[model samples]
Target chain A: EDQVTQSPEALRLQEGESSSLNCSYTVSGLRGLFWYRQDPGKGPEFLFTLYSAGEEKEKERLKATLTKKESFLHITAPKPEDSATYLCAVLSNQGGKLIFGQGTELSVKP
Target chain B: EAGVAQSPRYKIIEKRQSVAFWCNPISGHATLYWYQQILGQGPKLLIQFQNNGVVDDSQLPKDRFSAERLKGVDSTLKIQPAKLEDSAVYLCASSLTQGRFYNEQFFGPGTRLTVL
Candidate 1:
């Protein structure tokens, strides 16, 4: 069965603190890996998509790297405004659907 | 361009009642998706539509859940005889196309449903 797991259900970081969130997956065949940011009372917004192992993408203070079995979202000098739930999803070659992880709830305090 | 749009940002109802949520995907998007997001969890795809055709509905609860995108632009998701477990945020997303590995989906503000 295809499954995605995100570690550290919640994290509290001080402003300007850098951290990494993990997203591990088991899929038949990896087509792509996606990262999204979701704020309270809103739907998730697209962040990045990694299509292969050793691939990486970045946007502002967020960087996402992918591997054969997992992906990592590294935050650099995160601000309070950057606080939001980060979600990871995998699209398998077997189907066109995306399998999502539980997500990591991040809180940045000033 | 305007993003995906959803209606009724919030709804509260009793168990066993019926409710419907609507979604309007971005202009020219060829694919639409409906997802259920429980608190503290990632969004789960309930159905996927490609130009008014059902590409996937395997995860949707057929007995109580039904969705339609008749015009290939606007879609509606209905839950009949809602269960307490049905309480969650209904999210709608759209992409330029489906079956492409690089397609990025854009989401809308979800409709929060609370069943008592």
Candidate 2:
């Protein structure tokens, strides 16, 4: 079975504080790992897609790194505007479907 | 490009009432997907369509749920009798191809359904 799990269901941080969100997965074959940002009342927006171990992608203050067993999304100097649910999903090669984690609800307070 | 479009940004109805939602994918997108996201949860794939054909609908509850992409451009999801547990946001996404490696899905604003 393909499964994705995220840690620290929720996180609270003050402005300028840095933190990392974890996304661990167990799949038959990890085709790709994806990160998405979803705000309340809105659908998810794609962030980064990591294909192999040691791969990294960045956008603004967000950085995503991937390893064989899991992935991590590190936020630097987070602001209130960066508050949103960060979702991690693994594209399973078997079904060609993305199995998603429960998501990490991040709150960045000023 | 103008991203994916969806209808009925918000809908509220009692259980047992039927409802339908629509989505129009980006022009020329070969693959379309439907996902359900409950509050505080990640999106779950409900169905996937490649062009006008079904790619995967295994997770869809066939008892009272049905969907169609008649023209391979726009699609509709219908629930004959909704349940309270059905309250969630229905998201529609599309990608250039069905390949998982290079596929990056573009999502819509989604239709929020509240079943009372």
Candidate 3:
């Protein structure tokens, strides 16, 4: 069975605080790992895709690193505008379908 | 280019009623997907289509759910005799192709269905 689990179901961070969200997965054959940010009342926006272990990707204030069994989305000095639910998904080679985590709800208070 | 588009941002209905949602994927995208996202959970793929052909529908509940991608452009997902557990956000996404790598799906705003 392929499963993805995200930890720290909810996190409240003050503005300019840094934190990391975790996504662990168990899949038959890993193809890719994806990170997305979803805001209230809007669809999810693509963040990054890590294709292999030891791979890392970064955006303005976000960085994502991958390992053999898990991935981490590190937010550096996040701002209130950066608050959103971060989603993690893994694409398995067997079905070519993305198995998603429950997501981590992040709220940055100003 | 416009992103994926979904219709009826929100809908409220009684159980056992029928409803349908529509999706228009990004122009020229070869792959389309429909997902169900319950509150507090990530989106779950219900079906996948590649140029009007069903690539995957293993997760879709065929007893009450049916989807069609006619003309390889616009798609529709219908739920007949909806159940209370069917209340969730129906999201549509698209990608350039279903390649093994570099397949990033772009999502739509989604249609929120509330069944009572």
Model 3 TM-score is 0.98
For every candidate, C-alpha RMSD to the true structure in Å: 0.8, 1.0, 0.8
- How many residue-pair clashes does candidate 3 contain? 0
- Per-model DockQ against the true two-chain complex: 0.93, 0.85, 0.94
Candidates in order, TM-scores: namely 0.98, 0.97, 0.98
Give the C-alpha miss distance for residue A69 in model 1, angstroms: 1.3
Model 1 residue B109 lDDT score: 100
Docking class of 2: high
- Candidate 1 off by > 4 Å: none
Alpha-carbon runs more than 4 Å astray in model 3: none
Summing lDDT over every window of 10 consecutive residues in candidate 1 chain A, give the lowest-scoring window. Answer: A91-100
Residue-level lDDT tens digits of model 1 in A1-110 = 78999988999999999999999999999988999999999899999999899999999999999999999999999999999999999988888888899999999999
Clash tally, candidates in order? 0, 0, 0
**By summed lDDT, which 10 consecutive residues of candidate 2 chain A come out lowest?**
A91-100
Q: Give the per-residue lDDT digits (tens) of candidate 2, residues A43-103.
A: 7899999988999999999999999999999999999999999999998778877888999
Preferred candidate (DockQ higher): 2 or 3:
3
Interface DockQ of candidate 3? 0.94
B64-113 in candidate 3: lDDT tens per residue? 99999999999999999899999999999999888655578999999999
